[model samples]
Target chain A: MHTLIVIDRPPYGSWSGRESLDMAFSLAAFDQPVSLLFVGEGVLWLSQRQDASAIAQKSVERNLKAAAIFGIEALMADQSACQRFGLGDGTLIDGVETVTDLRVTMRRYDHVVFPG
Target chain B: MHTLHIVSKSPGHPRFLECLSMVDTNDVVLLTGNGVVALADSSIEVPSPLYALEGDIQARALTPDSARCQVIGFDDMVALTIQSQRVISW
Candidate 1:
């Protein structure tokens, strides 16, 4: 079954950001067709200049790159959310698709997750 | 401190990938409901102890009623957030 993972929280506000990623990788390992959607404050986690590791947190940029190794091919960023936040290309990780339209993708998945 | 790390998705996100790099393996990965789906993957490299919340068949495999599970919902996640030194939701 197809699954869509929704990430809505910011980088370090809560564990949702990390948990959502865990779920995405887990599903991908099982060979599920997984799609990742980033919305709201969640978009901040994708920025390229993030260096939260100094705060003793993991490097989100490196983690995102790890997803590709697991066979996950559907990382997506919400277009409107990005524009509203004034965060763009540099914020998102590599190998992620930017989705300006959400309805079509949301409807395609059998299971949709709100990871916070 | 006994920290609770809630994982709702697999393959992980950039922030989480960054977050784990900061955390030690002692922290627990709380996989609730749809979150339990994250645990089925053999590809994820996490060796952290994983606990599933209620409402998932997988949770039952871990424990009935998820008694051992770190409650992620059924209340404000922030409540538990205060109990522990931190709460990281991905």
Candidate 2:
């Protein structure tokens, strides 16, 4: 079964999003099919050059870079949310796909979970 | 229906808007907890075939419009979940 982990919270401000990312990695480690969908403020996690150092936190961008290496299937962002957040082709991190129809995209997975 | 979207956040929450955006015409929306507040908020445009938990409506003292939303008890909510091919809790 394909599991879709949806994160709608911004990174750094809360640990729930990070925890969700960790869960995705865990599922990947076990050879489970899992993909992540970022919507609302969660799309901010896909932005490039996020320097969390000043905030004394490890950058989520750095952690997400390892998602592919960890065998996570896909990293998706809501297109409208990306637009609202000003995340475009040049600003988003590499390998993140922006999806237009979220309802259709979500139905592809057997399970959908949200961060805290 | 294709999908059942369960929303527990208030209408003012960003996730509530996100949930609304993801709703398809064939999909059904169930309001629980703070989500039932949407029934009273006139500005929020809820989708058709909407449902609000009866307990939530009572707890919040909200009188949802009978025409616009169907109030369901726990058993009915479970039935709705079983009827849908997919369920997304937002």
Candidate 3:
């Protein structure tokens, strides 16, 4: 089954988004069909040039770069949320797809999940 | 309804706005826990066919506008979930 992991929380503020990423990576490790959908503040994860140095944390952008190598299907962001966060074409990380309709995108996956 | 969006976060929470943004006209929204705070928040424009958990509303000491939001009990909430084709808990 195709699993879509939804992340609606912003990065750095909490560990939930990271945990969700870990879950996606684990699923990909198992050769499971999995994709990530970033919505709301969660779209911030796709923003390029994230410097987490001041927060004493590793940058998520670096970790996200390994997703393709690990076989993760895709990284998607809500188009409207990206606009709200000012993440236009030039500002987003490479390979992330911007989807306009959240419902339709979600329905494409057999299973949908959100991180705690 | 196609989807029933259950929001348990407060109005200030990012998921609250995300849920509202994703809500379609045919979708129903049930506000639970801190989500009930949206009823009293004038700044947030909640979608129509909104329902707030009675217990949550009472706990928050919020009085929802009867014309806009219908207050529902646990049983009604259960019925709503069963009625909708899909349920999204945010």
- Tens-digit per-residue lDDT, A3-113, candidate 1: 678777778767868888898999899998777788777777777877776688887777887887887767788888888888766656666677875655554555556
The chain A TM-scores for the candidates, taken one by one, are 0.89, 0.97, 0.97
Error of 3 at B85 (Å): 2.5
**Residue B13 displacement in candidate 3 (angstroms):** 4.3
Q: Give the C-alpha lDDT of model 2.
A: 0.89
How does chain B score by TM in each prediction?
0.52, 0.97, 0.96
Q: Compute the interface RMSD for candidate 1.
A: 12.2
Give me the overall lDDT of model 1. Answer: 0.64
Clashing pairs in 3: none
Q: Which candidate, 1 or 2, has the higher DockQ? A: 2
Better of 2 and 3 by DockQ: 2
Best by DockQ: 2
Q: Model 2 TM-score?
A: 0.78
Cα-based lDDT at residue A82, candidate 2:
97
Give the CAPRI class of candidate 1.
incorrect
Give the number of the best model, judged by lDDT: 2
Best prediction by TM-score: 2
**lDDT (tens digit, per residue) of candidate 2 on B1-90:** 478889989988878887898887798999998999999999988899999999989988888889989999999999998898877877
Question: What lDDT does each candidate get?
Answer: 0.64, 0.89, 0.87
